[model samples]
Target: MLTKTKAYALKGLEGQAVEIEVDLTPGVPAMEMVGLPDAVVKESKDRVRSAIINSGFDYPIKRITINFAPAETKKEGAIFDLPVAIGILSAYDQIPTNCQDGYVLLGELSLDGSLRKINGLMAILISGLQNGYKKYIVPKENQAEASFVDGIEVYPASNLSEVVNHLSNVSPIPRLETKKFNGKNETSKYGVDFADVKGQLKAKRALEIAVAGGHNVLMVGPPGAGKTMLAKCVLTIMPDLSFEEAVEVTKIHSVAGVLDASQGIVTSRPFRSPHHSITVPALIGGDRRAKPGEVSLAHNGVLFLDEVPEYGRTVLDSLRQPLEDGVVTISRVLQTVEYPACFTLIGSMNPCPCGNYGSKNKECTCSPSQIRNYIGRISGPFLDRIDIQIEVDGISFGEFKDKASGEPSEKIRERVVKVREIERERFKGSKTRTNSEMTNEDIKKYCEVDRESQNLLELSFAKLGLSARAGFRILRVARTIADLEGSDSIKVEHIAEAIQYRSLDKKYWK
Candidate 1:
């Protein structure tokens, strides 16, 4: 007898349909799974066998051959355990096969037949729905993740016996109701607030512009100048992610297995702060399995790199492609995976190795050669991609002890949301979400500068010897500044502030 059940195999963030076909033939008692399965899929046979007997079902003594088709792609993960077990049981005439259609089965069966949650359940469920499969049988623990997908009947089962009971029409398991996820209430609110930072009005203004334009920023200052704190606070001031953006960000986290299972959907903009010692592959996304790296995990949010120059040259340089293309494509020998990396890069570094090179209260001990070499770790091309560069100074003792609080993130966020709305209206019917994503054509179309601003920009271009990419980045920043003030055209002051940000590169690099 032969039976077939539907399942899915994940390749990167997408899912490919896999049909689990089982054949029960009269021979020596043995089991085999074919079709390019990895070690985990092959080992499912033992799990399924033990689960079937423990669940009060007879393990067929016939030779059972299970095949996962299409026969070319390699299957990984234990998600195929349930479908494979069902296929074998149906082949032996223990359960009906008609119930398998229009349903996708995925779960890891334990030795005692209890269903265990598996990673990438959301992506698989979305893929199944996209492919016209509306019914899903997943582990009960994964019911929350699967419920995020609307228009689907998600039936979660606790053990193999429950699934069999449902299929046999003896007891029908209730389908889970889709609940509207409230990200605002579920998001964490314990992080650093903008009001906590004592004083750095200049740095605060630069961050507002950066968030408004979706531009990358770099801050240079000594330690304890609130660089890290300011970076953390930026999350609160930035505009919230749209529903589509949240889904994209959540999918990457899901694939990377970093998502919180209890939080069904990601609500807040992601903030990823990887250490400076992270590898090139870890920053850009590459490994044996081609898992998502920090950049991908920061999709539609921020990628904060503190002590930026401490990172290896190769690691910092790897960010150029994803910074420009808004995606990272990692090509392995077996497959090519594309991860969405549309994130705002916020990097912080000291002026020199001693971190007191430009401090008012401290004197630097590092030589010119050492300072040059230290900054040289960051390549010119990488530095050129950063849209805003500002130097932070330590707050005076008086400012630190001041009783007055700075502007709250809620106030800043309101202005940011307004600026984003303007950009949204400006870029309607287009792919871009902010001014930083604008191309040269977009600059010409939307970022038109008056005669005075053009003259000022030309002079700064000549004095700074800025590259054409740097020139465009300046225009993008200026446009964002103008947008923040509810201006339709870039003004001279906006261009001047943008030019001020560019001067830091020359100061540090020279």
Candidate 2:
């Protein structure tokens, strides 16, 4: 007898349908698997067998063969264990074949016959729904995450017996109740807030603009300055995640196996601060499993690299492509997978090895050669990508002891949300979301400046020796500043303020 069961496979963030086919014949007792399965999938045969026998079922000891259809695509993980076991049981007439039809099975089977929760269930179920698969049999442990997905009948099974009983109509498992998606149900607090930081109002203002326009920022300061604190406070002032953004972020986190399954969704904007010793693949996404790296994991959020100059030049340079394209593609011998990496970059760096090369209150000890070499670690081209670069000076004693708190993050977030709404209305029915994501065409169409602003920008470009990319970034930032002030056109003052952010390259890099 031959039987088939439906399953799903994950490749990067997308899921593909896989048909688990089982064939049993009255011959020698042996079992074999085919269809480009990985070692984990191949090992599922023993697990499936043990689970079936241990679950009070007769194991088919005859010649058995299993294949994952669409053999060209490589199948990985133990997501197929339940489906393979079901196919075998259905083929042997132990369970009605009609029960296995029209359902997608996804879980890992233990020797004790219990169903273990698997990663990427959210991605798989969402993809299956889009492909017109309605019903699913998932592990009970995944119920919370599965509940977030609507328009489908999800049967949460604790073990193979429960599923079999439910399918046989002896005892039917209740379908999971769908939960409504509320992106802002969870509070948007990150413990650290801008009000806690005593000074460096300029740095705080720059961070607000960076988060408002989704532009990259680089902060230069001496040791003990509030650069790191300012960067950490960025999440507090960021706009709330839309339902679509939350879903996209949740899918990536689910596939990476880093999601908090209890929450069933990610509402807060992600803040990923990788160490300086990170490798290229670790930051850019490529390993044996081709999992998502820090960039992809930081999708729709902030990717902060503290002490940026302490990082390897190569690793820092590796981010150029993803920074420009907003997506990282990891290629293997057989396939290439792309993960969305649209994130705001926040980098903090010291002026020199001594951390006081250009501080007004501190004396510098590093020589010119040493300062040049230290700053040289960050390439000019890489600095060009950053839209805002501000120097964070040491706070004065009077300012630190004033006991007056700065503006709260809640107020900053209100302005950010309003600015983001304006962008959304401007980019309606399109993919562009923020000023940083605008292309040259978008810049020409929306970022036009008056004669005085244009001439000022041209003069600044000539005097500062700015690259074309740098000039365009300044224009993008100016557009964001105008949007913040509710101005219809980019004003000369906005252009001047945006130009001030680019002066650090001349001050430090020279």
Candidate 3:
């Protein structure tokens, strides 16, 4: 007898269909699993056998060959355990063969006839729906994650016996209900806000611009200047993530297995602050299985690197590709995977070794060579990717003791949301959601400046010794600055404000 069941295999966030074929022939009673399965998939046979017997089902004593069709690609994970077990029972007269049609089964079967939750359930279901399959059988523990995806009927089962009972028409599980996402309602309120921070109005403005346009920022300041505190507030001023953006961000976290199963979705934008001691592979993504790194995990959100210079030179430089390309490709001999890495980078570093190289009150202790070596740790090419570079000086005790907050994050967020609406309408059909993502063609079409702004940019270019890339970055930032004030054209004041952000490198990098 022969039976076939439907399953799925995941490569990155994409789902490929796999047909599990079960053949029961008259020979020595043994089972074999083919089609390039890894360690976890190979171990499912023992689990299947024990689960079937424990669930009060007689194990088939025949030469059973479980062949995962399309035997070319390698399959990983234990997500195929349920389908393989179902195929064996259906091959015999125990379960009806016609019952498993049109449904994609995904679960890891335990030794005692229970089903366990597997990783990447959300991606698998999305891929299944994309491949024209609507019905799914997933673990009960993944019910919350499965509830968010609409247009499908997902039946959550707790054990192998429950799945067998459903297929046998003895009992059936209820379909999962779709949950509506209201980012405003679901968004977690942050404890710290812009109101809590003391001073540094210029730094606050720079952060607002960065968040408004999705640009990267670098803060060069001494210790106790609230660089870290200011970075946390970036999310507060930024608008909530739309439904489409939340799905993209959730897919990466689901595949990386870092998702909060109870929450079932990423309501707020991610703020990932990886330690400085992280390796290049861990930060950029690569291992035995090309998993998502910090950059990919921070997609549609912020990637905060506190004490950016404290990170290794190689690790810091690895961000160059993701920063420019908006994606990281991990290539191995077996296969390769690309993960999205579009994020706003917020980096902080000290001015020198003593953290007071340019302090006005404190006397300079580090020599010129020491200052050069300290700032030189960040390469020129790497620093070029950062669009905003501002120096945050220390504030006096009087500023900290003012007791009155200047501007609340809510007022700042209102302006940011309006700017985002402008960009969405400006680039309605394209992939760009902000001015910073403009290409040369986008720059030419949208960022044309008048004669006064043109002469100001030209003078800054020659006087500051700016590279061609640096000049274009200044133009992108200028476009964002103009958009903040609802200006239709890039004016002189916008260009001048953008120019000052580029001169901080000469102050320290030189």
Candidate 4:
């Protein structure tokens, strides 16, 4: 007799259907598995055999063969353990075969017949639901994560006996109800507020523009100049993620296995600060499994690279593709997987190796070549992608002593939310959500400049030697600036502010 059961395999973030087929014949006693099973899948035979016998089921001493259909596709992970065990039991008349239809099973089986939670269950459940699979049998631990998806009847089993008994109708298990996700907004209110910063109002303004537009920014300054503090404060002003964006970010983190089990949805935007010594593969995501990297983990959020010049050139440059395409593609011998990498890049660096190249009070200790080499580690192409580059100067003693509080982050966030609302209305029925994501077509259609602003941009472009890409970015930034001011069209002041941001590349890199 032969019995088949449905299962799933994860290929990167996506899921593929796998059919487990078990056969029992009257012959010599043995068990075999086929169909390109990896070491983990192939080793399921021992676990299945032990679990079946330990669970008080008749371990058939006859020739038993199991074949995973779609033999050409490579199946990995221990998620197949439960399905293989159930298939063998059903084939041997331990459970009814008709009971397994219209359901997908995924879980790792312990030797004692206990079910263990497997990684990537959320992605598998979402894929199954999208493919019209209404029923799922998962480990008990994954119940909350799997319940996040609606319109599915989930059965969380703890052991092989419970599953077998439930399927056989000897003891029926109740279907797990879909968790009611209230879909309420849970934005954070406590964080580093911009009002705490003493001075450097210019840098604060630049950060506001960056946050409003979803633009990337780089801050250069001496130590203790509020560069790092300002970067931390930007999170307070960022717009809250929509439900769709939350889903996208949550899916990525779920696949990366970094999601907090208590909070199923990633409510607050992520802020990833990887170390300077991070490898290229670790930064961009590539191992034997090709998992999502830090950038993908920062999707719909921020990737702050502090001490930017200290990082390896290769590792820093590896972000170019994801920066431009909003997705990272990892090509391996077996497959190519693309992960979302759309994120706001906020970076900080010292003026020189000694951190005081152009300081007003301190004398620089590093030589000219040292300064050049330190800044040269970052490539021009990467710098060009950054929309705003501001030099953060040290606050004077008197300014630091001032007791008057500056504008609070809540006030600034209100403006940012309003600006984002303008963008949302402008890009209605389109894919663009922020100024940074606007294409050349969008710039021409929506980011048009007046005669005075056009002349200012052209002269600045000639003097700055800006590329077409930079020019478009400037237009986008100018558009964002105008939106922040509640202006309908780009003005000369907006162009000037946008041009000021491009000065750092000329002052440092040129």
lDDT of 4 by residue, 454-506 (tens): 89888987888777777888889999999999999898999899999988767
lDDT of 2 at 22: 92
lDDT of candidate 2 over 37-57, digit per residue (tens): 457755787899999999999
Residue 492 displacement (Å), model 2? 1.4
Query: Where does model 1 exceed 4 Å of error?
Result: 185-188
Residue pairs with colliding backbones in model 4 are: none
Give one digit per residue, the lDDT tens place, for model 3 in 1-510: 888899888888888888999999989999888775556655888898999899999899999998987775547747888999899989976888668988899988889988887777778888888888999999998888888899889999999889988878799887888898756612237777887788889999999988888889999888988899999888888787888888888888988889888877788889999999999988999887888999999998899999988999999889988988899999987789898999999999998999888886576689989988888899865797899999888888899789888688888888888888999999999977788888899999999999998898889877887888888999999988999989999999999999989888567765
The candidate, 1 or 2, that scores higher on lDDT is 2
lDDT of 3: 0.86
Q: Give lDDT per model, in order.
A: 0.86, 0.88, 0.86, 0.85
lDDT per residue as tens, model 1, 389-501: 99998999999899999898888888988998999899999988799999889988987888998898888878887777888988999999999999887889988999999
Per-candidate TM equals 0.97, 0.97, 0.96, 0.94
Give the distance in Å from residue 184's predicted Cα in candidate 3 to where it truly belongs.
Answer: 2.2
Top candidate on lDDT is: 2
Superposition TM-score, candidate 3 onto the true structure: 0.96
Ranking by lDDT: 2, 3, 1, 4
The parts of candidate 3 lying over 4 Å away from their true place are: 185-188
Q: lDDT of candidate 1?
A: 0.86
